[model samples]
Target: MSTPRNVQQLFDLTGRVALVTGGSRGLGLQMAMALGEAGAKVVISSRKAADLEQAVMTLQDAGIDARWVAADASKPEDINRMVDETMERLGHIDILVNNAGATWGAAAEEYPLEAWDKVMNLNVRGYFLLSQAVAQRSMIPRKQGRIINVASIAGLGGNHPMMRTIAYNTSKGAVINFTRALACEWGHKGIRVNAIAPGFFPSKMTAGTLAAVGEEQMAAHAPLLRLGDDEDLKGATLLFASEAGKHITGQILAVDGGVSAVTGG
Candidate 1:
C-alpha cells in the first residue's frame, strides 16, 4: 500500500473543480469560499445575474479562483444548462454543493398548496436533478466525487412553537434521507455523499425567522449559546469537500453548536 498523505496534503483540493448552487449568498457562498480557499476552482450559480456577479467579485477579492453562472435551481432546464456550462468552462466537476433552498411560513392546517410546492420543488427536487446531472456528466465517469447537501437541524425533529415552516422542515427531512440513499447508490462509483445540517445562522433567508424567533432565544437553544458566525461552516465544509473525509459517506453532520443534541432540533 502507498504511504498515507499528510494532513495538509490530504485536505488540499488543488486541480479539482466545484459547482455550488444558490451560491450568491448565505450558507451557499460560505461553502463556496471554503472550497475555493482550499484550492479548488469554484463556480457559483443562482437565478440572478446581479447577485452572482457581486458574489464572484467578493470571492475574487479574497484571492480565490471563482466564477458564476445564473440559473434557477428549481428549473430542470436551468439545472441542465448550468451543469453543461460548468463542464464546458471547467471541463469537470469534482464537487457539487446542493445548497439552493426555499422556505415558506404557514400553519400546517392553513398552508397553501402553491407554497408547499414551491418549497419542495426548489429544496428537494432541485437537489435531486442537479446531483443527477453532475454525476452523470462528470463524477460517475471519473469515479470520484464529493457532494455536500446543506440540510438543517430542523430536519432532526419539529421546530420551536414560534416557527411555522412545515414545508421547509419536511423538505429538509427528505434531504437527509436523500443524502443517505444517494450515498449508498453512489459509493461504488467512488462518490461520497454527505450533508451539513446547520442550525440557525443569520442570512437573508433566515432574517425573518431570526426576527420572529428572537436571535437570543434561538442562540439559547444551542449549547454554544451563540448563533453561527460566518466562519462556523468553513471547517465542516472543507472536511466534507476534501480527502480528509474520503472514507466518510452517508453521514449527516450537525454544525448547529449542539442544538440538535440538546433539542433534537
Candidate 2:
C-alpha cells in the first residue's frame, strides 16, 4: 500500500471496519465515536443485547454506520461467535479494539479467589482470545490490521492503597506486555499492536473508586489538575487507528494527563 501525502488522509479512517468490545458505554463508546466520526464502519459488542441496541441507536443518531452484537468477551464460544457475526455482517475487520474488561475492588488480604479469576479472565485472557481470532481470521490473511488494547495507568505500578483492586491492576500490567509481545510477533505480517494506559476516567467501573476518592482529589495527582473529559481519548484513539500511527507498534501510550509521567509510568 502507498502512503497518503496529506494530513487529512493520514488521520482518516475512511472505508475501514472497526470492532470494539464493551462498546455500549463509557470509554469504549467514546473511542467508537472517534472511529465512526472518522468514517470507519463500526461494530460494537457487549454482553447485553439491550445495551447493544441502545448503543447502536445512539451511533445511528450521530450518523455513524454503527451496529452491535451481543457477546461475552470472557467466553471463548462467545468470542468466536462475535468474529463470525462480524464477518457475516461487515465482511472484514480492519481494526480491533479490545476494550472489554472487568474490575474487582477489595483489600489485598480479603480479595476473593473467584473475583480475582473473573477479573483476570475477562481483562487478560479475553483480550488475547479475541485478538487472536481477529488476526487469524482477518488480519493475518490480509497482512494488514490495527489492534488497540485499553490498559490502565494502574498497570504501570502499584496504585494508591485506596484503589484496592489487585486483580484488575495485575491484569492490566499483563496487558501492557501483551501489547508489546503481540506487536513483535505480528509486525512482520503488517499488523500493528499497541496499548493506551488511561488514567482516571469516569465510567461505571470507576464510579465507586471516584466516589471514595472524590474527583478533586483525583485531579490533584495529575499536573493538568483535572479528570479526563469526554473527548480526551479521541485524539489518541484516532492516532492509533488511523495511518497517523503507521510506524508505531508494540508501545504503551499513556493518556493519563501526566499522571503516569509524574508517577514513573
Candidate 3:
C-alpha cells in the first residue's frame, strides 16, 4: 500500500486540466474558479463569447491559468468541437464539470413540447455527449478522470407548488441517475463520476424563481436561513475534482444549506 497524503496534498490539482461547460457565469464559473485556484489549468465554455471573455478576465485576475471557448453545450457538434479544441490546446483533460443547463416554467399539463425538448437536450443530453467525447478522446486512454455533474435539489423530488418546471425537474433527476450509472461503468476505466445538487443559489438561471418567491421566503425554507453564495460550492467542487475525493464516486452531495436535509431532497 502507498502512504497516505496530507489533506493539502490530496486536494492539490497541480498540472491538471479542467474543462467546465456553461462556465461563463453562475455555478459553472464558481466551480471553474475552484479548480483553477487549486492549480489546474482551466478552460471554460459557453455559447456567448463576450460573456466568456469577461469570465476569463475575472479568472485571470485571480491568478488562475484560464482560457475560454465559446460553444453551446446543447449541440453535439459544438460539444465535439469544444473537446477537440481543448485537447489540442491542453493535451489532456483531467476534470470535466458538466454544469450547462436550461429550465422552462410551465405547468405539467400546459408545458410545451418544444420547451421540454430544449431543457432535456441541454441539461441531460449535453452532459452525456460531453462526457463521452472527453472520455473517448482523452480520459479513457489515460485511465484517470473526474466528472462532476451539477444537479439540483429540484431533482430530489417535486418543487414548491408555485414552481412550474416539470421539465427541469425531470432532467435533473435523470442527471442524478446518470452520475450513478456512469460512475459504475467507468470505475474500472479509472473515471470517478459524482454530482453536486445545489439548492437555491442566486444566478442568472434562478433570477426569475428568486423574484417569484421572495428570497427571504426561500431562505426561511432552508434550515440555514440563507441562500447559497458565490463561495458555497468551492469546497465540494475541489473535493470532487482533486485527489481528496479519489475514493468517492457515484454520490449525490447536496450543497443546499440543509434544505435537502430537512426536505428530503
Task: Report the alpha-carbon TM-score of model 3 versus the true structure.
Answer: 0.99
- Could you estimate the TM-score for every candidate? 0.99, 0.98, 0.99
Candidate 2's error at 253, in angstroms? 0.8
What lDDT is reached at residue 11 by model 1?
Answer: 91
Q: Candidate 1's residue-wise lDDT over 33-150, tens digit each?
A: 9999999999999999999999999999998999999999999999999999999999999999999999988899999999999999999999999999999999999999999999
lDDT (C-alpha, whole model) for all candidates: 0.94, 0.95, 0.96
Candidate 3 has which clashing residue pairs, if any? none
What's model 3's overall lDDT? 0.96
- Which ten contiguous residues of candidate 2 have the minimum total lDDT? 1-10
Tens-digit lDDT track of model 2 for 1-265: 8654798889999899999999999999999999999999999999999998998899999999998999999999999999999999988999999999999889999999999999999999999999999999999999999999999999998988789999999999999999999999999999999999999988999999999999999999999998897899999899999999999999999988899889897
By lDDT rank, best first, the candidates go 3, 2, 1
Residue-level lDDT tens digits of model 3 in 197-246: 99999998999889998999999999899999999999999999999999
Off by over 4 Å in 3: none
- Whichever of 2 and 3 has more lDDT, that candidate is 3
List residue ranges in candidate 2 displaced over 4 A: 1-4
